[model samples]
Target: MRILQKYLKGGISSHRYKQYIICSLLALFMVGGVCGEYFTNCSSLQPGQYLCTEVNIDPRTQQPRGCTKEGWAKVLCTSAPGIICTETNNGTFEREIPCKYTNGYSYETALLLSVFLGMFGVDRIYLGYYAVGLAKFCTLGFLFLGQLIDIILIATQTVGPADGSHYVISYYGAGIEVIRMDNMTYRMPQEDWGVVGRGIKEL
Candidate 1:
């Protein structure tokens, strides 16, 4: 009974730690102006280098007309009338990311994808479980029973990426601080893998 109690306590502690870590990261991102959700639209475009789309608003008709520029530019437009330029992140070009950060496989994303693709083992494969993922794929998510179990595990953060690295969700062209444990020690499962982007420079 004591052993079980200790195990439960450890598990709770670990979960809380991870939750706290995520919260702290979000807070830091917000304070540093590197928050990703805020950068999705034109209004929240950070004042840095970006590939902008030239948007011209007709003052008389209030209609928008513009063309995508083929190059990067410094955004200097506010919410004014007439012609204005907006930053584009259409994935065609790589612009400077103001504050690049890393994010793990979000519970919400995993949950949503699990509903549609879990039965076919696509979600497991996405999370990097190769052998078991292949098994589930072959067995149709173990005839759906395995999918149910995986859904629960993912929701509870019990099953993490098989590579032990978190997913990089908010990546700028530059480097930022990597995620660390509560003790300020790096938790990278492997070298040159856990941090965000192709070549992560730890800060």
Candidate 2:
């Protein structure tokens, strides 16, 4: 009874510390599962590799699975076992690629274009919103109010590809198994951090 009391009052572990640790880890995992987004670039990946964005940094090593960040805007990604790297003219290379998609239509791309050319409706046209692009172009982004709205939308991710497909930012590594998302707003299918797959949206 005294041991029980101590456990309840947090006075002693009574071998319960392991259980406490496990519960804490479970809670952390749950939180991590819900907050699923990570920022990365896909332009650095080889012609066919997709970006794997879901890799979590290990708390102990401060490293992600098969990935290392060498500098700002530079990530070195290593593939898992059984996949082979090849010699290339540029350097050593591996070429397990995913289905190609337009990299220029991604969220980051849209944000960039919107920042520079939204007033001219270039961003809208880029995302395949041709009619709206025309209107925005003629009206000068609805006198710039519409441009402001688009900026907010793209930043928030409430917008998506003009094809109405959802964009899912997932990590794709050479020789790694692919995980597909359904009913998403956009799909950024590459893994190199410099390139992105689709358009931006509000929220």
Q: Which regions of candidate 1 deviate over 4 angstroms? A: 1-104, 167-203
Candidate 2: residue 146 lDDT (0-100)? 92
Candidate 1, residues 108-199, lDDT tens digits: the string is 56667677788888788777777788898899989999999998877655676675543332222121234447875765676645455555
**Local distance difference test scores for all models:** 0.54, 0.57
Per-candidate TM equals 0.32, 0.34
Candidate 2, superposed: residue stretches over 4 Å from native: 1-104, 166-203
- The global Cα lDDT (0 to 1) of model 2 is 0.57
* Model 2 lDDT tens row, 46-72: 433443433444333233333322212
